[model samples]
Target: MRSRAIFLAGALVMVALLGGVTANSVAAATKTTVTWKLSSMTAGQNEWLSDLASTNSPGVKTWSKTGSCRFLPEGFKGFLSMGTGKSCTLTLKIAKSGKYPAKTATHTIIRAPSPATTTTVTWKISSLTAGQVKNLSDLAKTNSPGMKTWSKTGSCVLSPKSDPPKLTMGSTGSCTLTLEIAKTSKYSAKTSSKTMILALYGVGDTGPAGGTIFWVDMTRPEGSQYFEAACAGWSDRTCGFDLNEGSRDRLATWGCAGTPITGADGTAIGTGEQNTIDILNGCEDSALAKFADRLVLGGQSDWFVPSKDELSQVWVRREAISGMPGSDENYLSSSELSANLHIGMNVNCYSGCYIHIQKENNGYFRPIRSF
Candidate 1:
């Protein structure tokens, strides 16, 4: 009985010892360890990991570990890698400041052959200056090619992860934007801004004739008069007329020189139509004059042929005018150079030069009204 009791006590002690050893072994196996340190950093700047103190536990193969590094609030790129081995001399660069309120980056380390065992180290990033923030914000607002408007929504920013930032337009409009010029070896940093305006049209002013106010007759008095196209069309010469005396007359002999004539009598809007009609009255077959006399548009019958200068204004503001004939075609002007020929302007060219065409030929016509 004594021997059996002694044996039972020994067995109980052994079991207790074995249980303690097993518990200790399990604790050690589940323990996580990582030996890397990082200090705060500024955006758009580069730094080396070796500058900070780092180490590995004794008998631990840190080089065989795989992990990734990333910044919070997203949009941070180029700071992560997955591989074995401790990269003591690894380099890190943060391109742009991330979204507001948070600027933390996390580095995750996982044990090789068993990713279940892992650890993480977090580091903070310094916020950008007010100027830098503003510059980056402006760069975000820059317009891209084929964009026609400006956008004010969304946080505008440049990512430092990308060496050169890209700009794009968010909406359509003609507006101004400021941009930041990054620092380079050749040039110091600076700010650049530009205003985009429609070529001939001002913002929101449709002209006096109730159409898009494309061009302002700078030479005319304020509200004195402006011209608008009655409609967009080509070749209304069902009835043609002689340009000069015969079928052809030199501009030198015709009384229509020094054109773009405004006022009454063939020069002004209404007078110009009358003047062409009077000159071509006897011909009865005059093409341009007859076309102008029979024209009507915009619920009004006061439409007439524009003078050479007036036609030139249309050319100058063709982009803003909506329906001026294309540059590939030519249109007739009331200014006559000869009996058989009349002065015409190419709708595509804005220089206002005169081209002569036969009076009998059908050409483009965009009748005009004045107010």
Candidate 2:
């Protein structure tokens, strides 16, 4: 009986120890019961706690605070981090009324270097020049390791023809360029647009007739003022001279019976098309004028023989034109000097070709048109 009582007393002591441990276990719970952590964030980044997922641990009391940082949108759980240049600590204290002991979760926001940005996105030059190359890299100053893109939305042909373009302006108008830079680890993302005005066309540019642009009259009346000397093989019979005049077997003449034409004496830049029309109406068989009238090129059919002064302009800029027909110096002008002596001009080549088109080239013709 004495031995059994001793064993019974030891068992009672063990039970008391076990009961105390169970009580302590209920008072001190772990994160396994209620899950949460400090929101993920970057130190130098300007961001809101709204960018993060919220924690609504069921039936658990939550309290949060920060050191040398900010919580935004709301003070209890929302935070905006203007915390730059150093590590920011967000302390979250979570507890339950009768379950877990009060504990704090310290989250250190990670720090990284700031991004590089373009100082200015404006073009260095006042405007774009036709037939000249503009360096796009000069438009901005940045240490970003990524590329800068330049683009425009229109039918104008870029010189290299890429999405973001480098262009030789096709005509005279407005040219707007857009700069786009994608986000990168070392650089911030950015997009900016600027419009530039280019109101003049230079000689020696590609014209509407798929021919060389030799003259641009921005000062003339709007529409159809630029002149393109047609490309080689101007997509027509040379000079329209083979077909006899009207019904008679008469080759092209300044007028019927080589008679002096009455109103075919225009000699200016804007008068070539009209001169060709006048000659055609007067003689009804003028080939030079017919060639200019009937030719179709670059999807345009407005070709014409240049007048005397117009032909001079062509002579001065002949080198800028392509597919110049025959080396002869008897090229006819729509302007006539008299009955049998029609005004004419051609390239005079001595040391090389130079503009002395006070001369002529007859059979193979030089033609021009407006667009």
Candidate 3:
């Protein structure tokens, strides 16, 4: 009741100030309400909305603004925006005229800051093969959570026909994937491209050992690891899930009890196999849990624990493997950083996780052999 009296008194005052003539205008003024939206935005993002300033009054509507943001004309119909660039408060006014006079309401908008960054979108692989199936998330990487798109020139089709689409190489020929991530409020936009060839034995193909090839050291270099994208994937023997389990048993202490082992501490891409061998020879606790060194998968028994970098290679290209770990999964590397701490790789929505973790903490492990 008190609020109604205040509104009626305010409307009468507005009528008196405007020297109104019509009775209907007075009623409309008392019944109308206005709303303001305070939004934070990034400069140059050019994001706009339809209700930055709005009202619920009949008859012809009028709106106005005061700020650095683009107003009125840039806003279509009832739409409004603070516009773009350096921040400032935006004062807005809206009015509704019924019969003889117009009733007005006013409000202010809040401004915010935009952090600057150099955004980049990169392809995980440089080439592909025809009739090969691949996940889009595995093939491209972005620094922002913005839109991703592609424009190509060849026989290629994105499959499952859904958002964050998967890729299936169509028939034959060469095409390009334009890796792009558009700007969001926090980060800038970026784009890059990589050519994918529809040939045979590309990075994501199956190696002679029937494992997904992950690293093809470019020039073959007389003794290259493999000519593809990943190694064989194993899901049965998880690394850090249990203390009375495989990795914690004989594979305990990252090879030696209290000191870093010599050959087992390598953290590079081509060093995992050696690191595994060294661990097997040096640390032999009497337990019958299958470690990476004792694995005999894919018709070969040379499988070893991947080093830090090798584990990363396997992780980044995990989508190409048949049964790789999903999001929020972890893999132990053969690289030991300190007492009971080893390097490992983890998969998540956002990544940067090549750090030293507890050897018997969270996540799993998979062994990969360089054929």
| Top candidate when judged by lDDT against the true structure | 3
User: Residue 252: error of model 2 in Å?
Assistant: 6.5
- Candidate 3: tens digits of C-alpha lDDT, residues 1-371: 99999999999999886775565577665675656565565543343434454556554665555665554344463444454545545443334455423456555454556575778766676556667777888887777888867666677886645665777776677667776778887788887877675555666677766677777653333445463322433444322223233232122234344555557778877777777766666666411113655665556666666788877777677667535544465666778777567776666645538766765564466567765
Instruction: Please give the range of 10 consecutive residues that has the lowest summed lDDT in model 3.
Output: 243-252
Model 2 spans > 4 angstroms off: 1-197, 235-257, 325-328, 349-361
Clashing pairs in model 3, backbone N/Cα/C closer than 3 A: 203-229, 212-230, 213-228, 213-229, 213-230, 214-229, 214-230
RMSD of each: 24.3, 20.0, 17.2
Better of 1 and 3 by TM-score: 3
Give per-residue lDDT, candidate 1, residue 252: 16
* lDDT per residue as tens, model 1, 29-92: 5443344565333222233333332322232221211223232224533243333332213332
**What overall lDDT goes with each candidate model?**
0.43, 0.58, 0.60
All candidates: TM-score: 0.33, 0.41, 0.41
Let me know the TM-score candidate 2 reaches against the reference structure.
Answer: 0.41
Tens-digit lDDT string for candidate 2 (37-134): 43444554556443432333333534454554566555455455646546666555555433334555556665555545544344454344454555
Worst 10 residues of 1 by lDDT: 120-129
Candidate 2 local distance difference test against the native: 0.58
| Candidate structures ordered by lDDT, highest first | 3, 2, 1
